[model samples]
Target: MNLDWNFFEEHFPLAVSSLKNARSAGRLTHAFLLCSSNAEYRTAFPPLLASLAACEHPNEDFSPCGRCAVCREMAEGTFPDLITLAPSSLSRIIPIGESEDEVDSMRWFESLFYLSGMTESGWKIGIIHEADRMNEAAQNAFLKTLEEPPPKCMFILTTSHPAELLPTIRSRCQTIQLTDNRCKYSFPNSETLLPILHKLAFESKGSLLTAEDCATALIEFAETLGEEAEKTVAEKWAPRLAESENLESAGKALIEKRIKGEESCEYRRLRDLFLSMIHAYFAQLALLVSNTPAELLPNPELFEHSIRQNEAEEFGADRAFRCLAYAEDLLRAMRTNANDQLAIRAFCLKIAFK
Candidate 1:
C-alpha cells in the first residue's frame, strides 16, 4: 500500500482533501490530532499525513510523490526531521529517568524542539502514536513542548480514544475525526453469507479487517469444536453416560483446565476471534429472516428451527443484534484487564441461550 495516498483514499478522503487544501493555501496547522476508533487506521494514517506535510514535491492535490527522497525516507521510517514516540520498547509505559544523567538525556532529546529547523526544507514533524497511553509524567513533560510549539514544526498526535487524552493537550491542536468506511467484499453465489459477514464486520467496530480475520478464525474454530463435540457425543458420552460419576469427574477436570489456561494466557486474540464469529453468526440469522434460502447459509442446522418457525423477524434478527452488543462489551472489558475466562464464558452462555 502506498500508505501516503491509497490508504487515506479509502477511509478518510474528505480529510485528505482538506489536507490538500491546507497545503495549497499554505495554512497547514502546526499541530493535528487524528482521532479514530480503528487502531490499525489510527496507526497507519499519521505517517501518510506526515509524508504529505514533508513531501518535497507536495502538489496541490495533497498527495506525496513516492519517488522523492523525502517521501522515500518517510516511508522507510528513516526521515531525519521526523520523530515518533509511543510507550517505550523495553517497558510498556514511557520511561522516566531517576538519575541526573538519565534525566539530562531525556531532556536533551526533548530539547530537540528548541533547535533551529535542521532539514533543508526547514520543516520538522513529530508523531506520537497512542498519545493517550502516555503516563501522567510523560503527558506533563510533553505539555510544555506542545504549548510552545517551535517554528516550522508540526506535531501529529494519533489516538484511538481521543477522550482519554488530557483536555489541555487536546485543546492545543486541530482535531480531525476519521471514521471507518464500510469495506466492500464480493462473494460468488454465496449471498446467503453476505449478511452474516456484514454483521460481523459491523460488530468488529469499524474494523472490517479484524472482522474478516475473525470470520476465518471462527469458521475454523467452529469446525473443530463441532467435530470434537460429535465425536464425544457418539463415542465418549455413550460409554460414559452409563457411568455418571466418571462423566461428571471428567467434565469438571476439563472445564477447570480450560479456565486455568485462559487465565494465564492473554486471551485477547481468542476473544477477538470469538467476537467475530458471533457477529457472523448473527448476521447470518438476520439474512435468514430476510428470506435468504436455507441451503445458502453456513451452519444451516443452527438456523433451521428459527427459519421453519417463521419467527426470523421477531426472534432471529433482534437476538443477533443483542449478541453483537454483548460481544463488543466483552471485548472492551477484556482490553481493560477484566477476567478473561469469565468474560468469554459469559459471552458464550449468552449466545448459547439466545
Candidate 2:
C-alpha cells in the first residue's frame, strides 16, 4: 500500500508511462495481469496501480497524488473500494470459498466487487497477489467475475509464475510485462563469476585446467553463500534477541530453529541467483554467436567487455545453444536437490569437454 511513485517511474518508466497513458485516455482495461520475475515488483506494483485509478487528486499523467486523503487511505489499506487477495500462510494457496461469507476466498472476493463504489472516483479495484497460487477451483470461481465485473471495476493479477494460471483466466486480462532491468538477474557476487565465464567462453576451449578451476571456484562460492546467509540472518535477529528479557529456553530454541530455516532459504535464494546468472551468461554467448546486436542482449553491460575487445571466439552457434541447454539442465537438477559440488564439477566438465 505504501507505493513509491517516483521509484516506479524511475525503474519502470515504460510500464508506468503505458499505464498512465491508458488511464488518461480512458482506455484502461478492466483486468490486468502484471507479470514479473522479480518478487519485489510483483508485491509492490498492483496496489500502486490500484491507487492511481482510485486517487481523487491524481497528477496529469494519472499518477496518484500521495498527499490526498484517498491516497493515504489506500496506502494504509483502508480504502473501501480496494480489496487484495493473497495466498494463505500455511497452504500457500488461494482457495474457492465455501460460501460468499468466507473471508479472503475467491467467492468472497467476487462478492465485494458487486457492491457500489465507496469513493467518488467510481473505481472499485481488486488485486490478486501471486495470482498463480489460486487453485483450479479458485481460478474457475473467479473467471466469471474477471470476464465481467461491475461498472468501473478493476482487477489486477500479479504473478511471478503466469504459466501456472489457466489459459482461460490469462486470455481475459490485459498482459503487462513488469520487468525492471536494474535487478532482473540480480546475480549475487557476480563480480567473481563473470571472469570464469569469460575464460570458459574465449580463453579456454574446454580445457581441463580451466574447468577444474571453475568447479573449485563455484563450490567455494556456494560455501561463501551459506556463510553470508548465516551472518545476515544472525545480525537481523540480534537486536530482537537482545531486547527480550529472560526469554524461556523453549522460546529461544524456537527462535533459533526459525533462524536456521531462514538462513537455509536465503542461501538457496542466493544460489538460485547465481544459477540464473550462469544461464544468462550462456544465453549471451548464444546471442553473440547469432550476431545479435550488443544492445539487444538481456544484460548488455555484461557483454560490453567482450564486445569492446572484439573477442568473438571461434565457437559454433550450435555449441553456444547447447551450452544454454546444459545450463538449463544444471538449473533443473539443482532445484531438485542435486549435490551442489558434484553438479558444479559435472557442469564444468560438460563445458570443458564440449
Candidate 3:
C-alpha cells in the first residue's frame, strides 16, 4: 500500500469517489469510521484520508498531489497536524490517560486536537487505528471529544472489529466500510499455523506423541514472536539510531526507551494476529465440515490444498465447533495473564485429542 491515489483507485474506487464527492461539496465529515476486515486496507486508508484532507494541491477530483509539502510530511510520518494512535501497551488496549501529558493516551490526543498549529489546509487530523482496542473509559472519553469536536479537525477511527466499540461512538461518526475480496484473517504467520491446523484435523491419531509434536511447533513459534518483533523494530530504527550517535545521554536513553516500547507493542500485536489466525482456521474448519462451500469461507485459501468437504468427516463438524471454542478461549486467555506457551500447549493437546 503506497499512500497514493492509485492504491485507492484500484482497490477502493467507491470509497475514493464518495470521499471525493464529500470533499468537493465541502461536506467532508469531521469524523469518519473506516471499517474493514482487510488489514492492508485498514492500515492504508487513514494516511490516505489525511493526505486527501490536507494535501495542499489536490487535483480536480480531490485526489491528493503526492509531491507537495503536506504529502511529503505525511509520507515521512512527520506531519505536525496529523496524529495517529493505535493499541500500544502490553495489554493491547488504547487507554484514556490519567492526564493529557501521557503521549500515547486518548487524553493526549484530545489535547492535541485543540492546539493551534494549523497546516496549509487548516485541518488537523487524528486517526485512531484499531479503534475497537479502546477500552470503555477511552471510548467514553473519545465520545466526549466527538460530541464537542474541535473546529477544523477530522477524526478517523478504524477497526476490524466494530462490535467491540461503544454504540454512541459509532453513531457520532460517518462510517465507510471498505469492501474487498482479500482474506479477512490472513496474517504474517498464517502459513506456519495452517499446516499445524491441517495436521490437527486430518493427520492426528489422538496419540500423545502427535499432540506433543503439534504443541512443540506452536511453542517454538510463540517463543520467537519477540525476536521477530525486535527484528522489525531494528529495521525501522536503524537509520535514526545511526544519526543519533552524538546525542546526549538523556536523549539517547529516551530513544532507547521508545524503541523498547515499540518492540513490546509489536510483539503483542503479532501474537494477537497469530491467535486470530488460529481462530479463523478452526472456524473455517467447522464451516467446511458442515458442508459449506470453499468459496464462501472466511479463509477460502486455507482449503485450496488442505481439507476437502468429504475428507473433513474424519474430524466431524461437532468436534470442529468445540475446537473453535477452544481457539476462542485461547484468544481470551492470551489477552489476560495466561502464559503463551502454556496456553498453546494446552490448546494443541485439546485439539489433537478431541
Off by over 4 Å in 3: 1-4, 118-122, 184-190, 240-269, 292-300, 308-310, 335-338
Q: Note the clash tally of each candidate.
A: 2, 0, 0
lDDT, candidates in the order shown: 0.58, 0.75, 0.78
| Models sorted by TM-score, best on top | 3, 2, 1
Query: Candidate 2: where are CA atoms >4 Å away?
Result: 1-18, 21-30, 36-44, 67-135, 144-154, 159-164, 178-188, 199-276, 290-298, 305-311, 330-349
Better of 1 and 2 by lDDT: 2
Give lDDT: candidate 2, residue 301.
68
Instruction: Look at candidate 3 and give me any clashing residue pairs.
Output: none
Best by lDDT: 3
Clashing pairs in 2: none
lDDT of 2: 0.75
Candidate 2 lDDT at 37 equals 69
Question: Candidate 1: lDDT of 345?
Answer: 47
Q: Per-residue lDDT tens digits of candidate 2, residues 10-110?
A: 87788889889998987888899999866556656776778777778888778889878778766645465777776644455788989988866888889
